[model samples]
Every structure is written in structure tokens, then in C-alpha cells.
Target: MKGNWLLLIGAYFSAVFYSTAFCVVTLHVDPESHYLEGGKEGTLEIWLEGVQNSEEVFEFTINVSTNNEDVFEITDKVLVVGSIKSKVPYTTHKAGNALISFEQVSGHHDNADNGTIVSDVGDVYAHIYVIRSQPLNVFNIIVGWIYFTAWSMSFYPQLYENITRRSVVGLNFDFLSFNMLGYIVYSIFNVGLYWIPKVQDEYRDEHPGQLIPVKLNDVFFSLHGGLLTAITIGTCFIYERGNQSVSWICRVSISIGLTYILTLAIISSTDKFPNCTWWHFVSWISYIKLIVTVVKYCPQAYMNYSRQSTTGWSIGNVLLDLTGGICSLLQAFLIAYNSDDWPSLIANPVKFGLGILTIIFDAVFMVQHYILYADAHYSKSGRFLSGGGSKKGYKKIHDSEKGSSENSNFFRT
Candidate 1:
């Protein structure tokens, strides 16, 4: 029985290690990156970058076919930027990298349901390697699906341990709860997006043009998986941090970030975009909170660097985060690659800029995590507290003799 119990514990932690390491890559969520504006006639501009001049970009073809009505006609297909006469109603020529724009018929902007049809415009317009519905992007989809499944499966053991222990000694409650709530809300909202009448109508209208309904998968990744993993890890972190001000700050920051992003998404779902108001101010403030989090966590990152340790950090979690970041970058490439696919009436440069930022930060975070683990001091099981609760528990472990002796006493007790 003792041996069986030991085996189970070993298996459980092993699963945890693997799951956490591959968190982002495995549980990729779709972030909403596209938005639609209703009008009698409207235009969208998609700007493509990182492409060679006069290159035969097979991905540059903008296919727009609608089963509903062929009533619409392009007013101007070619945008005369510099000397290039691209397409009209859709244009391939614009200044800077390359610009693509589309013109839609007036008074037919939205479907019967009247809900906004927004997706990650970046993913749709960009010429990144990963195509949203293309068969070629199956690897990304498969990788993401596997990641999510693994994450969900791994949750059980940690949950069991938490239940048996009753107290989450190393858990961070605030971080966990806020992210849990955020992800839950995000998941439910995504499902709601499917059932919402406006969304359905919009999808029906855009059928053949863009099959999938407006969902968050475009911007961030997978709503359900990302939220679940984030919340789970966050809960552990909050519980571990206890009631310190730092804990409270984390909770508030996460809460604000979740609230701001979710609120913007909700507003974007409506016919009219929720313009700047007090809530908008709050949203921008929340954006700052995210920056603060990165800065605040600098010390933790520094500690990991100084000690050359991925000790207290979960390699599994960091790995997941890195994978998620890569996925986001892929999404960005898709958006920025073909800028001419969208209409000019509803394009926002700020959104694109922010998308760029997300990719950059994600890359940095992932590299840092890898660096920490590559160090000589990197341990398989992160720096977690022993169950004995001794005063020396917080002391860093470096010697095998001290570790073995402590382990013997711990098992003996």
C-alpha cells in the first residue's frame, strides 16, 4: 500500500511537470481579432508586411464569395499607393510593407441578427503560415488540441492533492480565482457567441467568405483552454502567496485585466463599438496593470536568473506559456501578412500595434524561461516547500548530503 501510494504521488507530480511545461502550446485558445462594421458601403484595409517586393505571394489572393447575394460590387479594387494599381473594391497596393483593402456594399454591413461579426482581423488579414481554416494549418490545430487535452487531464491529480491536503500551502488563491473566473467567463462568452442570434446571422451572411462565426480564438488562442490553465495556475499562486499586499496586487491586476479585455470584447459584439468612456479609461488603466505585472515579476525572474534555477517556477507552466506565445506570434503573422484582406471603414492601427507588442513580449518571456531551465541548478521538481514546515524550509537546497538527510528524517517522521 505504501509503495502504491508513493507510485501514485510520483506519477501525479510527473504529470504536473509535463502539463505545466506545455501549458500554452497544448491549450491554445482562439482570441477574437476581427470586428465588423455595418454600413450601406464600407471598406477595410489590411496591411501586409515582411514580404519581399514583387514577390509571387501565393497567399496574397483575397477570395470573397458569398452564397447569400451577389448584389454587392467593388467600387474600387486597386488602391493607387505610390505607383502600384492593386485590386479595386480590394486593393493590394499601399505604402509601407503592402496594404490590402476591401469595399463592401452599403446597408448590408450586418446580417439579420444584428450582432457584430468580429474575428481576429490580424489573423485573417496577415499572411502568416497558419491559415485559419486551411488544411495546411492542421499542425497548429493539432498541437493546440493536444495541449488542451493534456492540460485538462493533468488538472485531476493536482486537484486531488489539493483536496487531500485541504490547505493549498504553495498555492496562490487570488491569482487562481481571478484567472479561473476570467477564463470561465471567457469560455462561457465564447459559447454564447455561437448561440447569440446576431453572430449566427453574421456567420450565415459571411458564409463561404469566412465560415466560422466571430470568436476569440483569433486574438489570444483558445478561450476555454487558456482560461482554465491560467486560472488553475493562478489559483495555486494566489494560495501560495497568502495575504500579502503583493498577493492582493496580483489579484487586482489580473481582475482588472480580465475585466477590461472581456468588457471590450462584449462591447465589440454589439452593433455599435463601445467608444471611449469611463470604462475605456479603466480599460487603458488595466493595460498598464499588465505592464506592472511584468515589471513586478522582474524580481522573481531575477532570482531565477541569479540562482540559475527554474526552482520555484514550474517548467511545465513556463513551457506552456512559451508555446502559447509562439501560437500568438503565429496568429500575428497571419494578421500582418495580408493587410489587404480587410475593409478600410473599420481598421484600427492601434489594434495592429498592440498585436505586434503581444508577440514581442511573448517571445521574451519564453526565451527567459528556457534560459532559467538550461542552468546547472535547474531542478526537475521546482522549489516547493517541504511538508514538515521547518524554519529552514525556505532555505535553498544545494548539497546532496543535506538533502538526503532531510529526506530521511521527513520520511521517518
Candidate 2:
């Protein structure tokens, strides 16, 4: 308890420091236009530094311009800053800075050619704008990383448990099959959309204004999902408890049929059948993935219900998955709230809905394991029942043992 308390305290202080560092406001004057001339129009550029750390919509108010009303006129009274990480430095081939541009209107000056002309350039005064702060990025990053970590490690617990027990009796093979299919589709969609040049071109053409930069996190997330799914499938093969109702042939056929149908649908809709744009096909694949994710846990839940126990399933995996799903949902909410982009939430319903459903299913699993079937277990003779009655009586009863033994051989090598 004392160690846990110390860890909590340390985490709290670390979070506080990280948040402070992330939200620190810094501004730099652009060297090119620090000095400005009046009457002659020139852009007065002020760069907002550390904008990458901000995940909220904010306005940098030019309060100084209001004070210099008599001397100078500014075009933009307020500048709206977006939550997107600025690629200005990379694109413009300059140091990193979120550029804020303001047009300086002509200032009042005497005629230089006639009697007397006062140069406004020398006398012109430029003042710094006060930034209205929003520090949602700190929270977003923290929650995002937590979700990533949880998801990345989620499969290990179940895999380890299966290996140690040398059984996959309580696990639903259908659940694994569906999950692997979903991740395969998801990985293809993610990689094709972001990395393929042809897809990038088509996507840019379709949505010219939207800038969705594929970050390192996205790549890692996709890779992690794919890797874990493969590992879990391998573990399932190794720890076969012979309880699988679905045959390998049927599973393979279903996978191929689904893939073909999705592909055909995408191709038929486009002008170019086989040579259609990557973006169009990826959209179809994404929807398939969404459907798969929605129903992914159904098989496991049903198996648990029928067996009245979660004997072979790892509670650690469920807990980690639950944490990851909740964190993912929270991260999305934070992004939408901070950016004031409610439309995005509606636009990507699949991502948001998947998180919500995963969390709900995780909760149900917890209830089944801890409350509903608390004392449920499988007997040595392969009968599943509550562990409250006479153990010898249940063991001696072997009425169903012959049937179970026959079924268990179905998947045996």
C-alpha cells in the first residue's frame, strides 16, 4: 500500500510537470518582418512557438493593434489557431513555427514629395499579441499513450495463460478468427491509405482542404494490431483444446468469401474495375472492419454464457483491453472538445462506436468472470458447472463424458 501510494504521488507530480511543459506559451518575432513600414503595405508576421503541444482551438488577440489605432491599422483583429500540428517549417523550409500573418494597413503620413514627409517605418510600433490559452493537447497525449500501451500489451496475457495451461478450452475460436480478419482488413486500409502514393493522390483530389498527416503513432498502432493478432492465432493453434465448433476449412472459406465480396463491390462501383483508386477500395474495407469489430466479442461472450465460466480466458487481457478502449474513447472526446470540431465526431462514427462497444463488452466480460459465474469451473472430466456441490459426485457421473470425449477429438491432431 505504501509503495502504491508513493507511485501514485510520483505519477501525479510527473503529470503536473509534463502538462506545464506542454502548455508553456512561447512566441517568436519573425526576423524578416519584425520591422514594418506604414503607408506601404507589408505583412507583419508573428510566429506562435510550441503550437504543436496545443490541442485546442484558440485566438491570438492583437490587443496592441487596438491601442495603436491612430498610428497603424491592422487587417486581422483576431487570428484563429487550429489544433493541427504545423508543417509550416517543413513546407516553407524554415525553422519550426506556427505562422500568424497580419496585413498592416497604410498609416497616416505627410507627403514626402511636396512640403514634408514623415517616414512611418521608423516610428511605427509593433506590439505582441496576448494568446488566449487552451491546453487540451497535454491531456490528449497522455490518454492516447495510455491507450496505445494497453492495446500493445493486451494480447500477451491471454497468450501467456494459454501457453502455461496448455489449453484453449474456454476460448472461442470463432472470436479469434473474426478478430484476425478484422485486423487484417484494418491494417490493409491503414497502410494503403497513408503510404501508397496512388491512394494519397486520389485522397488529395477528393478532399483538397483536409490535411490528415499519418503520424508515427498511427503506423505503430496498425503494426501492433496486426502483430498481436498473428501471435494470438499462432497461440490458438498451439494450445488447441479440441473444443472448436468451426472447422479450419470453413473459417478459411468465410475469410476468402468476405474478402472477395468486399473487393468486388469496391471494384464494380468504380469506373476502373481492377485498376480502381486505392481510396475507394479502402473505404469499403474500412466498413468491413467496422462491422467485424462490432461483432468481434459476440462469439466469446456466447461461449462464456453457454459454458457458465471464463476458465481459459485471461482476466488480465480483459482489463487491459477495457482500459485501452476507455482511453481511446476519452482521447477522441478530448480532441473533439478541444478542437471544437464536433463534425469530426459525427464523421468518423466507426472509430468512436468501436471504442464504445469494446468498452461495453469488456464490462460484460468482467461481470461474467467476477459476479455472474464467480464459482464456475470445468471439472477434470470436462464438465462445466458451479464449484459448490460435491466434487466426487460430479466426477463419478460421467453420463456426458463419452459425448464430450468424441467432440474433443474433432480438432485434435
Q: lDDT of each prediction vs. the true structure?
A: 0.38, 0.58
Worst 10 residues of 1 by lDDT: 23-32
TM-scores of all candidate predictions against the true structure: 0.38, 0.61
Off by over 4 Å in 1: 1-178, 181-185, 198-223, 226-246, 251-309, 331-413
lDDT of 1: 0.38
- On a 0 to 1 TM-score scale, where does candidate 1 land against the true structure? 0.38
Error of 2 at 132 (Å): 7.0
Report, for all candidates in order, the number of backbone clashes: 78, 1
